[model samples]
Target: MDRVRLLVLLTVFVDILGLGVVIPVLPFYVERFSNSPQAVTTLIAVYAAASFLSAPLIGVLSDKYGRRPALIGSILSTSLGWFIFASGKSLLVLYVGRIIDGLAAGNLPVAQAAITDTVKDEKERGQVLGYVGAIFGIGFIIGPAIGGALGHLSVTLPFWFVGALAAVNAVLAYFFLPETRKQQEAHTHPISLNPFSPMKRAIQQKDMCSNYLAWGMFGLAVASTQSVYALFLNVAFGWEEFMVGLLFMATGIVLAVNQVFAMRNFWLKKFTEPKLELWMTAAFAFGYVLIGVASFPLFIVGAILTTFGQSVLRVVMNSQMIAKSNPTRRGEVMGISASIVSLTAAIAPLFAGWLFDLRPSLPFFAAAVFLGIGFFILYSAQKTLPTTLDPRQPVVSEI
Candidate 1:
C-alpha cells in the first residue's frame, strides 16, 4: 500500500480500537451507576445523537479548513472524552463524555474523504476500503481481548489505556499525516451547520434519495441489533465478560477474512455493486431471523452470516457512494452519508432497548424486518442507479 493509505488505515485502527475496548465493557461500567440495560443503550444513543448533529458540520469544516487539522482535532477530542469517561463519578458525567466524543465523530468521514482524495481508480478504491475494513476487524480482535482482561482487574483500566492511545495517535497525526485536499479548490458554497441540511440536499436528488433511504434503513437494522447483543447473550447463555469479548472477536475474524480474502479479491470482480448489495441485504435479513430463533450452535451460524453479509454490504455501498460523488465534494458527500447513519444510530438504540425490555428476541425480529424493507428498496431502485461515474458531471442531478 501507499504511505497515505497506510496512515489512514492506522488512524482508523486506532479509532476503532477505542470503540472495541469500550463496547463489550460499557454495559457493566454503566451498571455501576444504573442497574438498567436500557440506561446503557440510552448512553450509546446519546453519543450517536450528538454525532448526528455534528457530523455534517465537521465535514463542512474539513472541506473549508483541511482534512489533517480536522482529523487531529477530532482525535484529541476523543482522547479527552475517554479521560472524562474514566474519571467520572456520576451518570451525568458519563453523558458529558459521550457528548464530547460524539461531537468529534467526524474523524471517520474525514479519513474516508482523505482516502477518496488520494485514490482515483474506482476498482482500486473498493479494494483499499476493504483494507480499511480489515484494519477495523483486526482492531476489534485485539482490543476486546485486552479490554476484557483488563476489565477483570478494573472497569476503568481499559478506558485509561484507550485514552492514552488516542492521545498518542493525535500527536502522531500532527507530525506525520499530510494534507490531501487541494488548496485551490478548498472553498465551496457556504456550508450549513444545520444537521438536516445534508439530508435535504440528498432528498432533492431523485437518483440518490432511494439509495440514501436504503443505506439509512440498513444502518437502523445494524444499530438496533448491536444495541442489545451483549445483553441477549447474558440473558440467554449466561456468558460472562470474557466470553462476550470472545464472541465479538470471533465475529471480527469473520468480518476481516471476508473483507480481505473474499470481497477485495474475488467478489468485486464477480458481481455488480447493486447486485452484491441486494444479495447482502437478503443475507443480513436471513441472518437476523436465524439469530432471533437461535440456540447455542445455531447462534454461531447466524453470527457468521450476519458479520459476513454486513461487512461486504458496507464496503460495496461505500465504494458506490464515493464513486457517484463529485471528486471535489467527496468530503461533503461522505459527511452526509455519515449523518444518515448517525441519525439511525441515534434512534435505533432507544427503540431496541425498549423492545428488549419487552422481549429479548424482539430487537432481532425488528432488525430482520428493517433489512427486508431495505432490500426491497434497493432492488426496486437498481435500474436507475449508475455503477460507474461520469467524471465531467455530478453523479446525481438535483431536481
Candidate 2:
C-alpha cells in the first residue's frame, strides 16, 4: 500500500469521524431552533447545494494543482465549518456552517483522486479501497457514541468537539499526507473556473458518460437514504438523540465487519461487475421498500438490510468506475462522477424533507422508486461492463 494512500484514508476516516458524530444530532438540533420542518430540511439542502455546485470546480483544481493540496485545503475548510456550526446561536449560523462544509465537499473526491493517482494496478486499488472503507466504518462506529455522550453536555458540544477533532486531523494531514498527482510530467491544461468546460470535457468522451450514469444512480440511492433517515427515525419511532446514535453505531459496526472480514472477497466473488450492480439494485430496492412499510421492528430490519445492500453497491460501483476509466482521463471521469453524485445528494435532502412532511413513509417509498429506476438503468446497461472481477482500463460511451 502506498504510504500516501494510507494517509489520505486516515484523513478521510478522521474527517468522517466528526461527521458521523454530528449527523444523528443535526436534525433534532435544528428542530429546536426553528420548528419549521422544511427549514430544518433546507439546512441540509443548502449544504448539498454548495457541494453540488462546487465539486466539478474542485475536481479540476485537483487536476491542475494536485490532490494533496486540494485535500489539505478542504480539510482546513471543514475544520472552520465545524467551528462556525458549533458557535452558532441561531439558525443563520447553522446555515453558514453547512455552507462552509458544502463548499469544501470535494474532500472525499479529492481523496479518491489521490488513491487513483497513487495506485496504477487495479487489484491493489480494490485492496486499498477496501481499507479505506474499513477506516470509514471505524469512524461510523465510534463517532455517534462519542457524540451521544458529549451531547448530554449540550447539543452544541459535539459540533465544537468535532471541530477540534477536524483541526487535529488537518494538522495530521499537513505533516504526513503525500502528494499523488503526476500532472507535472504530463500534457495537461491548467484548471479553470469556467462553468461549461468540465462538463464539456466529461461528456465529450463516450465511455466517460456511460460510467458516469452508473455513478450517478448509485449516488441518488445512497443520498436519499442518508438524507431522510434522521427524520424517519424521529417521526416513526420517536427515537431520542441517543437512540439515533445507537442505530447509526449499529450500522457502522455492521459495515466495519463486512468491509474487514467479509465484503471485499465476498462481493468480488459473488457479484462481479455489472452483474453485481444488478444485485445491488435489487437489494437496495427491496430494502427501501421494506423501510417504507416497516413498523418499529421492521425499521430496524430495513436498516440492517439496506446497510448490507448499500455496502455492496458502493464497492462495486467505485471499483468499476476506476477500472472502466482510461488512465489518461481518470481524474476527469472521477470528477464528473463526484459532481453528479453531489448534485443528487444536494437535491435529495430537499425532496426527502418535503416527502417526510407529507408522510413519514413518503421518503422511504420515494427512495424505493428512485432506486428502482437506478437499478433498471444498471440492469439494462449491464452489457457495457467487463465480465469479470478483474480490472481493465475503462471505456465508456453512449450506446
lDDT of each: 0.83, 0.74
Cand. 2 Cα-lDDT: 0.74
TM-score result, candidate 1:
0.96
Cα deviation at 174, candidate 2, in Å, is 1.1
Residue range with the least summed lDDT across 10 consecutive positions in model 2: 390-399
lDDT of 2 by residue, 1-399 (tens): 556776888898998899889988887778778876677667877887787767767777777677777787888888899899889889899899989987877777777767767665655666666666777778889999998888878988999999898889888888888778775523166666774576777777665455567667667666766776777777778888899899889889988887776765776555555776677677777788888885767767787778877776666677777776554445555566677887777777777777777787877777777777777777666666445433334555411
Each candidate structure's TM-score, on Cα atoms with residue i matched to residue i, is: 0.96, 0.92
Q: How far is each candidate from the true structure, as Cα RMSD in Å? A: 1.6, 2.5
Alpha-carbon runs more than 4 Å astray in model 2: 183-187, 388-392, 396-399
Backbone collision count in every prediction?
A: 0, 5
